[model samples]
Every structure is written in C-alpha cells, then in structure tokens.
Target: MRHLISIAAFIATCAVLVWVFLPDPVPVETAPITRGDVTVRVEAEGEARVREVVVISAPITGLLQRVTLHPGDAVTAGQVLAQIGPVTPALLDSRARAVAESTAAAAAAAVELARSQLVQAEASLTFARAEADRTRALFERAALSQRMLDDAVLAERTAEATLASARANLAVREKELDSAKAMLNGDYAEDTACCIHVTSPVTGRILGVRTEDEQVLQAGTPIMEVGDLQDLEIMVSVLSREAVNIAEGAEATITGWGGPDLAARVERVEPGATTKISALGIEEQRVEVRLSLLAPAPPALGHGFRVTARITIDMAQNILRVPVSALFRSKGDWAVYSVEDGKAALQIVSLGRRNDEFAEVLDGLTEGATVIVHPADTVENGSAVEEKPLIGG
Candidate 1:
C-alpha cells in the first residue's frame, strides 16, 4: 500500500508542472470574409430648390397698389398681379402753363400742315395714276415707247410711296398734338384714370411677396418671387477633395426630408469652390453638386427643404471584402490578423476601396476566411487564439 501511494503522488506533481508551463490562448472576435457588392459613397447634407427662380419686379416707377397675392398662390401667364397707378401730376405754375399751351398750339399747327401735305400727296398720286394709264394706252396704240410707259409706272409707284409716307407723318403729328394737350391738361385735372397693370410672365406658384403693402416703388424693384414645383432639384455642398471623385450622372440616395428615401442623380458639379465655415469653425473649400430627382418629389418637399444625400462614387460587385474594423496599418502597409486553425496570423493585404463599414479586398484574402476584428495590442503573429462569444449570443 505504501508503494502505490508514492507512485500516485509523483503522477499528480508532474501533471501540475505541465499545466503551469503551458501558454494561455488569447481571446479574440472574428468575422467572415464576404463576397458581395461593395460601394464607396460620399454623404452630405443637401437642400431642395427650384431650378428656375423668377423674381417679379415693377416695370415702372409709380404708386404700387397693395398686392393681393401671397406665397404659394398659383398664377398663370398674363395674369394681372398688381396695379401701379400713375402719380398725381404737380400743379403747373403760370409760366409752365403758358409753355405747355404754346407747345400744344405748335403741335396743332404741325397737324394742320401734315394734313395739307397728305391732301396734296393724294392729288399727286391720282394724277400719276391717270398719266400711267394714258401712257400704257398710248403704248398699246403704238403712239408711245416702252421706256415712256415704264417711266409713268415708276412715277405712279413713287407717288404711292409718297402718299403712304404723308399719311404716316399726319398720324404722328396728330399723336404729338394729343400728347402735348395731355401734358397741359393732366397737370390741372383733378381726376384721371391712369395706371399700369403688372402681369405675371410665367405659370407657377408665388414663392414669396417682396412688396405686399401699398407704397411707392422705383422701376425694377422686386415685387415677388415665383417658381414651379415641377422643376425642383437638390443642391449639395461637399468638400473639394470629395467633389473631385464625384462624377456627373452618378446615382444618389436622398433621405431625411420627412418622407421615404428617394433616388436622385448628379446633374452637374459647379466649377467654382466656395468658402464655408464648418461646425468646428474651420474654413473649408466647398464645391456645389447639383442633383435632379429621378422621380417626382413628395409634396412636402419644396424649396429650401433639408435632406441628406448618399452619393455612390464607386462600386464593386461580387468581390471579396471584409469589415473595415479588421484592418490596421503595419510597416507603411495595410495589415490584418487572419484567423487560421485557432491562431492569429498577421497578413499584409491589398485593398481597392473602403467605406465606413467594409473594404474591398484586392488580394491576400479569400471569401469565407475568418479575420480578427478590432484586435487588441496583445494579439500578435503566431498567437494562439480562441473565439470570444458575443454578449447575449
């Protein structure tokens, strides 16, 4: 019995020594390499806007009547928008009145002279026509030459042209007389119906009323803004570095405008860069990227509405990829801890494109391979590892 007890004691002591010398396995989280579509996207806040914003302005300086139109009011072409009444003329002094009366008298004399000239022209044209007829008759009877007949016809044409000119001159003189008389009488008249009607030159909804109250305004003063909702588009500003990668016609996904996600496409990229201050107060060179909605926008989406745009700058399909958290820098190259047979093997990997969540694997990885995610500093090459179960798994 004493010899058996000594042998059992020696076996237990050897077992403890072996366990103390063995290395502990490092706990690690692992993820599988996937083969699927990988997309590189640039995201930024954007605003919806009308492509064409028209500002209605006053065409003349006058008393602007109160505008009855409001924002979102529908308007059509040639619709009367507002009325600008002519300002009341100042009462003329005695000398001014005298000058105006003299001008009116001169205009009246000019009208009389023009009317006499027009009557003379009419008589001349009638005589020319008679001569032309007589010359043609004489030429047919062989009493006149073809040249004489041509001369008479030319004379008649000239007389007709003169008659038309005299009639136009007489009409101009009559209008001048009327204008002079108006200038003299309007200064003294108490009541005159005179106003310019402002009309809408487009078909759209009023975006805003710039001058809604009655007041005096100068010509070219803005009255209101009009825009069509059907021409709504999106405008996005991105960092200049990212803008270089965005191409025209690239697809984008829009969200956060109180509606479902909508699809859009890049229409253009503005050539100029604008300076903008970021939330951190840093100055950034921002470039504008204009996008057109692929479908009609929701009714709630209108001008100046805020939205988020995720633009696809690059894409790769059916490619091997892994989570971005698995990648780390090593010796000036990208590296990852690839799991092989319960061991972490440090691998240098070639990558193509990367986004926030995943990266495209160009080489040094295969689909279905396991990689350590967010490896700790203690995890090194040739380290023994064990899969750490996720919480609640």
Candidate 2:
C-alpha cells in the first residue's frame, strides 16, 4: 500500500512539473512595435533646370570680325559684345568729301534762289496794291475811264499770279536744298565697312559663343545663350496615370543627382500626355510636370541634372502610426493584431493618412502599441506570441 501510495504521489508530482515547465506553446516570434511621428510622402525623379533661357542671335548677316566676349563671360544689358568691321579710311574720306562739297554748293544755291523769289514776290505785291489804289483814286476823281481801270486791275492780277508762282517755286527749291544738305552731310554715306557691334540684350553669363573670329553668320542664327542661374526650376516626367493625382502647388522633396536634397513645389502640371515607347516597345503615356525650387538653388544644381524627387501629395502628423504590413482586411474592414502580454489581440482599426511604409491609426490603437507585422493566416485572435527583431530594425 505504501509503495503504491508513493508511486501515485510521484506521478502526481511529475504531472505538476510538466504542466509548469513544458515550453509555453512555442510562442511565434513577433517584432516589438514602437511609434513616433510618421511622415507620408510621394517619390518621383526629375532634373534641375533654369527658369529662363535666352538664345541670342545676330539681327543681320555679316562677317563676325571680332568676338570680344567668350562663353561664360558675364555681360550687362546694352554692353557691346563684338565689333564686326570698321569703315575703311579711303571710303570714309571719299564719302566725307563728296558730302561736304555737295552740301556747301546746294546750300549756297538754295539761299540765293529763296532770296530772289522773295524779292520778286514782294515787288509784285507792292505794285499790285499801288495800281489798285491809283485806280480807286482815278474813279473817285472821274478822270479815268471804267475800261481803263479794269485793264489796270487785270494787269495787277497777272503780276500777282506771277509772284505766287515764283513763291511756290522758291518753296520747292528750299525743300530740295534741305534734302541735298542731308545727303551731303554723310547721311546717305554707306558705312558698309564699319563693324556692326553686337550688344547683350540681357544681363547674364554667355552660355555659348557660336562664332569665332571672321566667321560669317546668317541672319537669325543663334550666336549665344544667356540664362539666369539664380532662378531655377525642375522638370519631371511622371506616368500619365500618376500625374492625374498631382496638382499645382503640391510639395516635393528633391534628391540624388549630385546636390543635397532640396525642397520644391509643383509649378505646373502639363495638360498634354505624350506616348513613350519603352525598351520592350510598349506604349506608355507620360506627362511632364514642372516644379519650381522653393529653396535657394545650389551652385552645383545645373540644367538637365537628373534627380530623384518625393512629392508629398498627402500628409499627417502626430498620429498613431503602424507598419503597413501590420494592416490586414478582416471581413471587408481593416484590422491589426495588437500584441500585449505575449499575445495578439485582433482589433479593428480606423485609419487616416497612409504612405508607402506606414498607415496612420486613427482609432482602436494608441501610440507605442506593439502590433504584429505580417501575421500568419493561421494565427488566431488572442494567440500567444514571442517578440522578435524586425529585419531592418
């Protein structure tokens, strides 16, 4: 009876020990959940560009006799850039002499002719008045016949007509003399040999110098380019489907092309979509978006510099944030497992802003709550769990 009793006791003790020490239903490894401020952002890639680019060209075709400036030279408005050609000494002298002689002779002739015409017109007018006065006096005194008075009046009229014609001729001569003077004063002289100096249209650094010494340039050919480096913008191409959600004034973070990350804002979303052929020859619709750098542009930022950009179309701050993998659909509603006391308690959650990595927890979860990421499909609610480090932690 004693041995049997001792055996029963030992069996009972072993059962108790097994119940106490047997591995607590091997707890599945889980990551410790921690939360802080989370930021949601959209990522994109693009290139830096100047806000304004001006292409300079010669207004007339001529030999580029001199290029006083070269590429990268700083210039101001109206500053002379280059001189084409100078007037030849012989031609200049010839033009000067011809203009001088012609002008002097023409001026003398004009003055003499105008004086003569004025004197004649004055004499005619005086004679006509005197004859009319004499005719009136004769009629009053009854000493002259009416036919004689009339004949005298006709004579006066003829003299007046002649004076008028002379005055008109004098005016024409005066105009001709003025024109002759202008031509003789080198106004009509062709300065074909003189260099046509090109001037800067705007204050900027010359980006290019197309012509060297004595190169002939055609009209409207671009000779140089000028741009304001201070004012810079970024142009990015986005997938057509993604572009629809982007709007003007959206915030963007630009990075990776040589400079530090920069903050930019969308200036415009181009309306037109273009078809792009991929390496696989698949047609893809894309749109170009222009972004103006809000921050001061770095000196290293240059035109066509490729960059990676993250455009923030949506954002939220100071919210309960959880890893996106922790979110799962439960009966058409979003749910997550809140790990507490080494167990996952399935809890439905209301969510707010979401980004590529995290989802904002609006309700049913608090900051610092441990949540299971990528919970197993077989894992049941209120199941035991063991904490494990995340891969990238």
Candidate 3:
C-alpha cells in the first residue's frame, strides 16, 4: 500500500510540472468567411439641383417695379411676374434743355414741311386726274394719240404716289416731333398701364428672386430663377480616379437629406476634372457626377439641398468574402490570420474588391472558414489561439 502511494505521488508531480510549462492560448476574435454578395461602392457628399434652371432677366433698361412673387410661388406660362416702366428723365442743365428745345422745334418744322408737301401733292393729283380724264375721253373719240393719253395717266398715277409718300413722311415727322417733345418735357409718368409686363416663360415654382424692391435695372439683368421641383437631380463631386469607375446608369442610393434612403441612378459623369480644396487643405482633382432619383422625391426635397450619395461601382454575387478588419498586408501582399484547429494560420490572400466593411476573397479563403479579426501584433502563424466572446454576446 505504501509503494502504491509513492507511485501515485510521482505521477501527480509529473502532471503538475507539464501543466506549469505549457503556453497559454492567445484569445482572438474571429468570423467565418461568408459566401454572399459583395458590393464595391464610392461614397461622397452631393447636392440636389433642378435639372433645368431658368433665369428670368429684364427685357429692357427701365425702372423695375417691385416684384410681388416670392420664392416657392407657383407660376404659369405667360403669368405676369413683374413690370418695368420708362425711367424718369434726368434733370437737364440749361444747355441740354436748350438743345432739346431746338430739336423739338426742328421736328415741328419738319412735320409742317411734310404736311405742306402732302397738300401740294393732293392738289397736283386732282389736276392731273382731270387732265387724264379729258385725255382718255379724247383718245376714246379718236381725237388724241394713245401716247398723249398714256402720258396723262402716268402723270396722274405719279402725283397720286407722291401724295401717298408725302402722307407717310408727315406721319413719321409727327412721331419724331412727339418723341423730341417728350424728352424736352420729361413726361414719363409712373403708371402701371404703361409699364412693360415681365411674364414667366415656364410653368413651375419660383426658386429664387434677385430683388424684391423697386429699382432701375438694365436690360438682360437676371431678376429671378424658376425650376420644376419634380425634376430634381443630384450632383456629386468625387475623386477623379473614382469618377472614372462610375458608369452612366449605374445604381446608387441617397441619404442624409432628412428623409429615408432613396434609389437613384448615375445620369452622367463629367469628362472634365476640376481642382478643389479639400477640408484638410489638400488640393484634389474632382469630377462632377449627376444622379437622377429613380422615384418621386419627397415634397420637401428641392433645389440646392444637401444629400449623401453611395454609388456602386462593382458587384459580385455568390463569392467568398470576409470582414475588412481581418485583412492586413503581409510581405507586400494581402493576408489574414485564419483560425484552424485552435491555431492561427497565416494566409496570403488574393483580393478582388473591397468596401468599407467587407472585401471580396478571390482565393486562399473558403466559406465557413474562421478568420481572426483585428489580430494583435503578438499573433503569428501556428500560434495557439482561442475564440473570444463578443461583448454583450
């Protein structure tokens, strides 16, 4: 019995020694390689804009009346938006006033000359008509030659044409005299009836008004902007490199504009690149990409609103994928520490595409295989490892 007790004590001592010398298993968080769809997307901030924005400008240089229409006001084609009237004449100096008076006098004299010419023409026409009638009567009776009768008719027609020309001259001279007199008298009264009405050329809501107060404006000055809210689209500026990958008609999603996620499609990617200063004070070449909302946008969505855009550049289905956190560079190649048989196995992986959360595993990984996520520096190949429970799981 004593000998048996000694042997048991020796065996227990040997077991304790082996247990003390053994290395502890390294705790690691792991996830199984998944076979699912992986989408590669590019994200950027964007703005909602009207696809077609129309600017209404002043048609003539004049005194612009106060605009009654406000932003967001519904407008119809040919609806009167504002009115413009002739500007009040400036106060003229003595010399200028005298010159204007002389011009008025000259215009009046021209009108009188035209009127006298008209009277003389009418009198001549009457005399020629009587002579032509007599000549025609003589020709009919074979008492006068056809040539003489033709001369009389020609004179009568010429006199009638001269009378008509004189009347036209008189009317033109009278208008010139009236214009000169108006300038001399400075008689531009402020009347809405005489104002030129500015009308909207489209049926839509007003986007913006340049000014609401009455002021003098030159012709072609923009007064307001109009656009259809229903035709809203998004404009996003992305890095030139990323822009090259985004194809026209690619699917996208929009968010962060005080609404639910909205579906959209890439309408176009601008060919030209623009230099932009980034928030970090870095100069970046960016290209503008246009996106069209697939569905009717919310009623609140309007021009110049902010939005977040995520454009899918590539996609793969039924492929092997793993969390991006598990990936790390090893010897200038993509690698991950995959857990196998309670040990960490280093894998040099061939990757295809990646996004914020996941990466496509082209090779060196299989579905249902567990990989250590965010492995520590101490982790290495063939190292003993144990799965760590997730917090709150």
Q: What is the lDDT of candidate 2?
A: 0.76
Query: How well does each candidate superpose onto the true structure, as a TM-score?
Result: 0.67, 0.56, 0.73
Question: lDDT: which is higher, 2 or 3?
Answer: 3
lDDT by candidate, in order shown: 0.91, 0.76, 0.92
Global Cα lDDT for candidate 1: 0.91
Which digits, one per residue and each the tens of the lDDT, describe model 1 over residues 1-393?
Answer: 999999999999999998888788899988888888889999999899988998989999888999999999999989999999877778889999899999999999999999999999999999999999999999999999999999999999999999999999999999999999999998767646657899988898898899999998999999999888888999999999999999999999999888999999999999999999999999999999999999987777888899999999999888888889899999999999998898999989999989888899989998888889999998999998998733321
Tens digit of lDDT per residue, candidate 3, span 1-393?
Answer: 999999999999999998998788899998888888889999999999999999999999998999989999999989999999887768778898899999999999999999999999999999999999999999999999989999999999999999999999999999999999988888444434559999989989999999779999999999999988999999999999999899999999999899899999999999999999999999999999999999987888989999999999999888889889899999999999998899999999998888887889989998888899989988999999999743421
Candidate 2 segments exceeding 4 Å error: 1-38, 65-71, 82-194, 209-214, 278-282, 325-352, 362-368, 374-385, 389-393
Which candidate comes out best when scored by lDDT?
3
How many backbone collisions does model 3 have? Answer: 0
Model 2 per-residue lDDT tens digits across residues 116-187: 977887798788879888997998899888997888788788888878888787878877777666555544
Span of 10 residues, lowest total lDDT, candidate 1: 384-393
Using lDDT, rank the candidates from best to worst. Answer: 3, 1, 2
Colliding pairs, model 3? none
